[model samples]
Target: MSGDVVVPAHNGVRRGRPPQTPEQADEVRARIELATAAVFTEHGSRGLSVARIIERAGISRPTFYRYFGNAEQPLHSLLTLSNEGLVGGIRDALARSFEPVQLGIAIIDAYLEWARGHGPMLRPVFAELHDPASPVSGYREEAFDDIRALVRAKFTELGRPLPSPLDLDTALQTCEYVVYRVSAAAHPGSEPDPADVTEARLTMIRSVLVTLGNRADVERALTVPGIFDERV
Candidate 1:
């Protein structure tokens, strides 16, 4: 008498048939990735092992390999997920406004909000990005480039030329400094409201623009050459 094989749902107990849907696979992968991130944050990425992930995730040992090829892949996914969420804020800021000063404020607010939302995942990613020896050290360079390209497009639309000493890379680095310092002050983990964070970020942005003499630079960067080109 042949029946069917069963798969476990919770606490390592078999309760259902095999997962056959893409959604199911994605859900499983997400759970495993989250578990891996939690463990890695506690143990460090290099210290994580397949056996430990299985133990931490409460899945079978082979289940770990079935989802992620190895520990590093899931760890990377977690970091990427954290970064993606942060980037989403930037994307939102861009969508919300074209005025450089407003956009700058939006960028700062978005960064602070992301930190408040994902402090656990971000702490390690932030630490790794700053540490030259960490595997993720070079990752932020690509992120910076992406952001600069975005800013460049905005500047071109505003009929402003890129300023001297404020090339794409330098601009990104400057933006990154704003994010890091604001995030540090916000202490998302302890903050009761994001108002203080937002206020602090606005003040910081004003100071940076004044000190760098970028107020005009920002205005020029956001000037649209044609009315037809404006989306909103």
Candidate 2:
């Protein structure tokens, strides 16, 4: 045995097992995202820094970088997640075959609930999307597509042929934007009662859908089975 006998190296061993797969990496990403959202709420998304996020997440800088290239990546991912939740609700409301009026009401109610639940996330979305400087910044095409598919399904249910005309696109754009605006108004400082705002929103949406075509068909469609069964 030489005086410089080698000792087995245990230098890089982690205290616990590491996450093994991409799914685990995604899970870590999700945890970092949630922690980032909490931190953002306390210190606005724009104010969030990589060090602050890493500190809040209780993760090393390397761990943070593994999931998010920088602070903005997590913030953007969070916004996408938030938007996806809102889009899911829109899809649900559309699935329920309510009258044009009922559909509008359902959409408004669903959206309002989402805004109430995710108030912090909405602020950044609004700021980014509403800013003239940020073209294509806030709008998620995938999210809007989820909503459009739902509307298309309702149209199909009412035996309406899909129009190649831009009319349908215009109508959907109006309806979605109305909900977005109403939700922003309900965001805390607005004078309007959320309930009343929702009602007013639905009324406006109904008017638009009716103007496009088939108001009565919307009503009849709502009366059909599974629309309001509540069991769903």
Candidate 3:
């Protein structure tokens, strides 16, 4: 009868009324995240409130507070989820390509596709991380580390050297900046039309290729019709 007192473990298992299976707990967590994203997309972080999130998520106040201490916690969760999705997509894309140039193009396309799909949810999270005064800024380093690891893994797999004139870390950091710019532009409020988004994605891909000393690959990638188009 005291569902309100249910406590969740690190793995998301909750000890409470009727006892939820791990899968159920995961579903609950995912539901909360999806609802958080939808609400955040509709109302910027500045306007976000616990009440609204709980309402949108269709969960009790106790449930919301049990999973997240505050609005920022869910935002952090969203950021983590976004990174997981991006990394997973990149891994899958890499698995499908044997050619180094094709792998590079796939990575770029994977990133842009993920951003385009999740930009609404990601914009405010990124905005907070970019703000020096925001407590969420601490997450910036974590994000950078995740991205760097992904880049390192890709280079290792391809057995290709990183571009000269810049160390791997520096090159990845620069690439992160390019991703940030593209993600910002793709944010729901500022998203360009489809044609413009395609152009921007291609531009980012070309820039990435050049930075990685793969300019020749860019021309090859462009020769494919709708090469930049989001894959189903």
Q: How do the residues 38-83 of candidate 3 rate in per-residue lDDT, one tens digit apiece?
A: 8777766666788888888899998887778887678678766676
In order of appearance, the predictions have TM-scores of 0.71, 0.63, 0.66
For each candidate in the order shown, give its overall lDDT on alpha carbons: 0.64, 0.65, 0.68
Give one digit per residue, the lDDT tens place, for model 1 in 1-232: 6898676669996676675699887877887887887776666666778888887778887777887888888877866766677676777777786666666666666766776676555556666677776656666666655666666666677766754545444545655665566555644445434665555565556544443336574455345342113455
Task: Write down the worst ten-residue block by lDDT for model 3.
Answer: 163-172
lDDT of 3 at 85: 74
Which candidate leads the pack in TM-score? 1
Among these predicted structures, which one has the highest lDDT?
3
Q: Compare candidates 1 and 3 on TM-score and give the better one.
A: 1
Weakest ten-residue segment in model 2 by summed lDDT: 223-232
